[model samples]
Target: MSLGKSRLWGVVARGMAMGAADVVPGVSGGTIAFITGIYQELLDSISRVGPHALTVLRRHGPLVAWQYINGSFLLSLFTGILISVVSLARLIGYLLDTYPVVVWGFFFGLVLASVIPILRRVPRWNTGAVIYLILGVLVAIGVSELRPAQVPATPLTLFLSGGLAICAMILPGISGSFILLMIGIYPHVLTAVHELQLVKLLSFAAGAVTGLMLFSRLLSWLMHHYVARTLAFLGGILLGSLKIIWPWKLPSDEVAAMGDKMAPLMSNTSPWTFAEVTGESSYLLAAGAAALMAVLIVLAVDFWGHRRGAHH
Candidate 1:
């Protein structure tokens, strides 16, 4: 599929959205890709960047190899992602710090609405699909329930963390940022982005590339073979993760005792109960509006994608 200039820019815009989603702890960029109707293409493109592409280059030429792997699409998409992560890092960090509920409200709505498209991808429903969905929910909830662990800030650990987190990042409903949070390097990674720490950033990027290459093939194969069950499972993961992104939260007793280091492990609470528990305004109306806006935005994107597909 050749992308004209406008379509190329459209892919970039989608990448920006994905990057923004990735910055948040409870939102996955993979979900954004799925919603924007590019998830499969993205996986296929990445999966091609191995020995097959090298062979193509040897037999044909660099240009043919690049075209075979949809190099322009990957380049344009990642360019947008890089621009967004670099530009929005500080801004998103500030928003999360100052307006936690509103920020989380947007992400929660995004993830919530995203589940529709994901589930819709399932070709058919059956007992196997139902079982996979349930299993996915259980796995997501189990991962969410884990406490944060401390790790050294060494390069090796950062590389490993990057690999692990990137795997989660590309999986629908699983947030790479949240994985970093669980691994106790969320702040450091954010700081590295914000501060332009080249060494740290490069280490993380190396790991991310390694992980992306390794995982994309497996994902593509699963998507090709067991698309229905896989999508069912992914949709269930999105549903199960709603607990983590709930706008109103209170620090668990243990989390409170652990101080700032463990603040991300908060327990979800109702908006009404939030004020009483935290002695702060719940901002329920604001949060609700933000969530509604997010949902509307996703719906608009979905509508546009479908229209484009129909035209094609």
Candidate 2:
């Protein structure tokens, strides 16, 4: 394919992968972007909607702001994520209920598999990187243990939450919805989305746009000026999040209602211990292992292809 065509397909694939990840709670689309070698570009694209965007909007008009929006990239990626979330929400919810173990097992495998590429990306193995990795792992474990809370779902709060959560969504090792959950806003935000509440959605979108622009610029700066340390830090965060994303577990004592759905408020137990030995556990483990292996293989192939192109 031509370069343009190849790039087009690449974006499309990325969108689809991101959408798929967003459909799952623990997994992140940002991780997928990183593994696919588009992390920096993705960040840069978001950063493009910087202060200059607002400046243009004020000096010129909405059209100028529109111009600043990197429509192609944002549309492709977000469309993918939106499609996945909308289409798979019920399916994923069902799976999580009926076959929770297997689903989580697969996610565990994915996170485990991701460590390889993240580690390989480090230009050098050093004490700093090791420390960062450990720190990241610890943070992820800590976040996993946090309890979910309920918050009033007002416009302002929803807007702010959306902004922050969306920023997290774009960053590997961060889960936007999980962040929402932490802020006691996940249920409301999700409810708004499910009900197609345009006002709430738009408010949230505004926050997301603002946050993405500001955060992306900061991320780009860090990546350009402190590539190793930044990536190392992100790698560590990804590692830490493994605890959050690990599949398999006991039911929570706390639950919250969002319309008809009853969601778990916190994880009071770990996935390793089970009440009993069952075929479900075995099936989930195998499935999780398989999914993780698949991601690893795909990443390896992409890396090899990149290397070949560079050589030629």
Candidate 3:
């Protein structure tokens, strides 16, 4: 299971893409993994971080355990993810503030484009899967509707936020940053990253690792045993999140320091009515172009992946 250097580098590149997506509040890194055809493999790799891997390590030594658990791939991927997050967090935060529509519009397209390929992969499609999909949609919408909490950002809170956010990050439709935003921890966490607060960052990382180790197993298990229903639910999540990523929004009074003009609360509005209501340029064409590009990019990736698979 050892990979060539080029293959490891490819994993790193994919991890960077996932990390970039996770930085956005309305985007999931899992979306990148899914669209790129590595979603199950990623889950399997993460799920290997427990007893079986350790037992192998003790019995067969480092190399055997490493290969057995896909350790090289996971290590390279997570290394790239960490590097990307550390380096790009500030830039992404700025984009979210300054070009909200364009950023969200592009990701909206990414998520939308991802739905078909993912849904098609379901092992069995039936009425029950449809019901679960609808249910997932409802739950996601409900989540989107809830107001951001004004909770205090204590150490314990940050730990919990890290755990919850990491769990969300791995789920196809849930955005970890959005979970942080919902709990009023997004800004605080961003501040830590921007300021290079080692203690806070380390604590969050520990929590993230714990959450990933636990939740990824559940996700992997579902993929193996109940893939149809899981895909339907995840697809529904992507569908429902469209509300969050809608291009036009009316801002609420809440403000945060991280955003130069960040509005805390926003409600989606029709594109036609956006400029009239907000008295700002709708940037409809720009957003539409971005959306188009997003769709094209996803299709291209999928097509290329299939081609590569065939070549193999």
Candidate 4:
């Protein structure tokens, strides 16, 4: 295939993967983008909608700003993500509700397998990289351990939460919706979006646009100047995030009643060891492992192909 065709296919594959990830709560599309080696490009593309874009908008109008933005790239990538999210949301939600262990286990494997591709990209390992990795891991572990907070479920709050959550959504190891959950906004924002609350939805969209544009620039700058270290840190974040994504559990006793609607609240208590070992559900773990292995194999093939192309 021509280089352009090859790149096009690669982007399409990435979009699909990203969409799949976005459908999962703890997993992140950013992780898929990072693992697939298009993270920097995505960040750069987002960052391009910057001050200059605002200036163009002010001078010429929204059309000018749209022209300045990489609309094609954004449209293609986001369309894929949107399709995946919308199509899979109900299915993923059902799986998480009905077969929580299996779904989470699968994600655990996927994230674990992702580490290999991420770490392999670092041409050199050093003290700084090691420290960054450790730091990232620690942060993830800490974040995972944090108890979810309680906050108001209001339109403005949902808007802000949407913005912040989407920003984290784009980071390789961070889960945007998870962040919303932490802030007690996940349910509210999701409800607003689902209910077709136009005001809330538009507000949330504005916030997401602002957050994506701003955060992308910062990310792009870091990737440009501190490429290796940033990736190392990101790898650590991914490692840390696994705790949250890990499938398997003991039931939580804590239940919060939200206006007669009872919701199970996860506690700090650890899962049962027995459940992890001997259970009919043990098959799920094996399946998860297989899925992870498949991801690794696909990544390896892509890497090999890219290397061969470079050599030729």
RMSD of each: 2.5, 3.9, 2.5, 3.8
Per-residue lDDT of model 3, residues 10-111, tens digit only:
989899989999887788899999998889999998899898888999999999998988989898889889988989989989988898888888988998
Clashes of each: 0, 6, 0, 0
Relative to the unseen true structure, what is the C-alpha lDDT of residue 186 in candidate 3, on a scale of 0 to 100?
79
How many clashing pairs in candidate 2? Answer: 6
Clashing pairs in 2: 102-284, 104-247, 106-288, 136-236, 137-240, 140-240
Task: Sort the predicted structures by TM-score, highest score first.
Answer: 1, 3, 4, 2
Query: What are the clashing pairs of model 3?
Result: none
Query: In TM-score terms, which candidate is top?
Result: 1
Each prediction's whole-model lDDT (CA): 0.87, 0.73, 0.85, 0.74
**Candidate 1 lDDT:** 0.87
Q: Report how far residue 27 has shifted in candidate 3, in Å.
A: 0.7
For model 1, the run of ten residues with the poorest summed lDDT: 256-265
lDDT agreement of model 2 with the native: 0.73
Candidate 4 lowest-lDDT run of ten: 266-275
> By descending lDDT, how would the candidates be arranged?
1, 3, 4, 2
Q: Compare candidates 2 and 4 on lDDT and give the better one.
A: 4
Model 1: per-residue lDDT, tens digit, 1-312? 467899899899989988888877788899999999999999999999988899999999988998999998999899889988989978999999999999999888888988877887689999999999998888889888877777766788889888889899899889987888777787788778888999999998898888999999899999999999989999999898887788998876754113244453478889879999888999888988999998998888888888988998
TM-score of 1: 0.91
